[model samples]
Target: MKKFDVLTPIGLVVGVVMLIFGIVTNGGITGFFSFIDPASLLIVLGGVIAGLLINFPVKDMKHIFTVIKQGFSQNEQNLDQLIKTFVTLSERARREGLLALEVEIEKVKDPFIRKGVLLAVDGIEPDMINDIMSAEITAMEERHRKGRNILEKAGEYAPAWGMIGTLIGLVLMLKNLNDPSSLGPNMAVALLTTLYGTLFANLVCLPLASKLALKTDQEVFLKQIIIEGVIGVQAGQNPKLLEEKLSAFLSSKERQKAAELITSGEALNDEA
Candidate 1:
């Protein structure tokens, strides 16, 4: 199922506000179109691309599209549902033993959870299971860092390129000083590069980088929950005790919700 995210809408709203304000301030839609200088766009965008190419390998550069797609996609982890599933699994393992998890592994959707359960069913030591899962988590973190880093570099380079475009505009305007009337027009055209750069950096690249970091945090937090859940299962922890332990990951309000789940016997019912 797809879930709606507020990030994209927030970004779009902010962008639309800037667009409308710019058009109105510049004396309507026609004047706003005058701000569109192909040369400025080339300088800002081409320079950003050049900077990215310099800072990251081509393989890493390829991930920009993937990151954009990921930003719009639904968050993969459903913590509440995950907790219930873990509790159910823990109760079953406590009763029928780890071998029973073999039949249930096929029913698990998350590959990470399934793998951890399978490892336990195969009698791997808890420490070894942790070591393997921790390594996988570390690898996931590194991949996310790579993507965030690319957007960060783009944000940094954009403004510098914009300044470069401003300088180029100044030089050209000065060179055409013989036509004094044309100077202001030439200068305005040059400054448009800086405007483009600022807009791209502040509105597009920086926000995207921040969003990617937020997404990374959510993913890592979810994975940590899974890791803890799997370890609790392996050690034959009581379902209620395991729930209490996992509840530590939530906030005060969320903890209260979990407590209600326990008190209302909803968790016990799931175990049954």
Candidate 2:
């Protein structure tokens, strides 16, 4: 299951608010308007976009928004629930045989788990199943890397474009040296572009890219657990031993939590 990741939006809003607050505290609300340089914004934003277009293919560009969206959501990995599921599947397989798991597969939501279980049921060799599933994991990692590369490049482009905007403003200011009145506005444009670029890169692009990478790592970890569980089931390992093997993947804290959940579940079952 996926849930909205509040931290991304909250962090962005906090950064903006703090920036606005800093401006207001230093120069008041009216002074905040001085920072709004449309031309500077256009230069930084347009330059970044153009650089990305040149850097990546059109098909990849189309998925940029989708990649960003992934940063705002997270997969809810309940390790306890996942372990319990595999344990149940293991027991059923040991009791009723591998073919019986076909009915149980319908109750499994994750396509990866379903596919692995189905492969086992089909009597595929354990080595072949591991090879096939491992290949899928590799492909998934590659896709994530591609998506993350776009954001990483965007972060890199933002600051460079800001420098370009700064140089442009500087040239313009130098050209209008005689016009004392134009100097302040031109300077403001120059400084604001750098600010915008730095803020966009640090606060948005780089952060989101890092978050996506972390999420990808977490997902890969979960899938690895699934792979082990599937393989254990196919091998007809003792359910108790399989649970112990899978539980090894959890941290001490997670093991404690899983134990608590298992105890509670068993209590509920006894009561029923």
Candidate 3:
């Protein structure tokens, strides 16, 4: 399941607030108007968009919004609950044989887990199952990399385009050096472009790319655990031993929690 990730939006809002506060503290509320340059924004944002269009195919670019949306949401995978589920499945398979798991597999919500369990029930060889699932993981990684690359490139281009805008502003300012009154406004344009570019890159693109990368790593890790559990169930491993095996994937704190659950007999009752 996926849920709204409040941290991303909250972080963005806090950053803007901090910038506004800094400006207000230094030069009053009127200072905020000095930083708002429509021309500078156009240069930075337009240049970034053009660069992305040139860098990626139209079809791929169409999914850019979807990719960004992912950073605002997070998969809710409870490792402890997942381990308990596999242990329960292992116990059932051992008691009644692999074919008996078909009904239980239907109740599983995760397509990855359902596919793995179905393959095991179909009597596929363990090696073949691992090979198939591992290939899918590799494909998923490739797709994620493509999506993340767009954001990364946007981050890279933002600063460069900002510098370009600054150069343009400098040329115009230098052309009318005799006009002392015009220098301040021109200099503001030059400096604001760089500021806009840096802010967009650091605050938005790069952070989102990092978030997507972290999410990808987490998903791959969970899938690996699923692969292990599915194979163990197929092999008819001892339920207690299988639980211990899956528990190895958990952190020290989570391992302790799982141990406590088992010690109190809550895990078995929950499975039952």
Candidate 4:
């Protein structure tokens, strides 16, 4: 299945709705247009970017767009289906030997799972397999941490920049206090910078960071399942026992499907 995510669009719609509703309630369309202060925008956004660039390396900044995309993407791991497949592979390996898994390896879609199974079929020592696979998992986690930290820093820095903009605006407004007309526009820039900062931090950066964290948990869980299942296969575990062991990874609803699949012998049938 495709892993497209809906969070990005949903969050954007909600934010836009909030801005529009707040503006329309205040002074209709005029208030909405009045909020468009280019100087305020530049101060908030540009300052935030500049702050981030200083805080993090340029290479990390280069992947900001990619990291944001990943935040919105789904992990696409179906636990019930995965458990069933593992059960099937274990039974085949037990009956016909690990070499029998060679054909099945080609059908496996996830590269991480495929690599683990390939190592098992190749007769790699269980300890060696564990070492290699565990290293990969560690590296995956570190990469995820880096991406999350970037967003987190953005969340942290946004408000700081916003405050800077507010101060800048305040200074400009106070300097032109004699001109009453300039007061309103200058004050608007100050307040708008704060609003932009708050919106970006709460509505975008922080939320994306949280979402990426949740996604990392899911991907890590799926990868753990693969690592465990492959090691069980290498150990020549009984298929039924392996199924029972792997079922621990599933939720209550998924556990029911797992039980039915094992009972009906449908999981083993897939190997036929």
Candidate topping lDDT:
3
TM-score of 4: 0.93
Worst 10 residues of 3 by lDDT: 263-272
Ranking by TM-score: 2, 3, 4, 1
CA lDDT scores, all candidates in order: 0.81, 0.89, 0.90, 0.83
Can you write out model 3's per-residue Cα lDDT over 175-236, one digit (the tens) per residue?
A: 97999988887888799999999999999999999999999999999999999999999999
lDDT of 1 at 248: 83
Candidate structures ordered by lDDT, highest first: 3, 2, 4, 1
TM-score of candidate 2 on Cα atoms, chains taken together:
0.95
Worst 10 residues of 4 by lDDT: 263-272
Candidate 3, residue 119: how far the Cα is off, in Å: 0.8
Regions of candidate 1 where Cα sits further than 4 Å from its true position = 1-6, 256-272
Per-residue lDDT of 121 in model 4: 87
**Residue pair clashes in candidate 4:** none
Any residue pairs clashing in model 1, and if so which?
none
**C-alpha lDDT of candidate 3 relative to the true structure:** 0.90
| Candidate 2 wrongly placed segments (more than 4 Å) | 260-272
Candidate with better TM-score, 1 vs 4: 4
RMSD after CA superposition, every candidate: 3.1, 3.1, 2.3, 2.5
Selected candidate, larger TM-score, 2 vs 4? 2
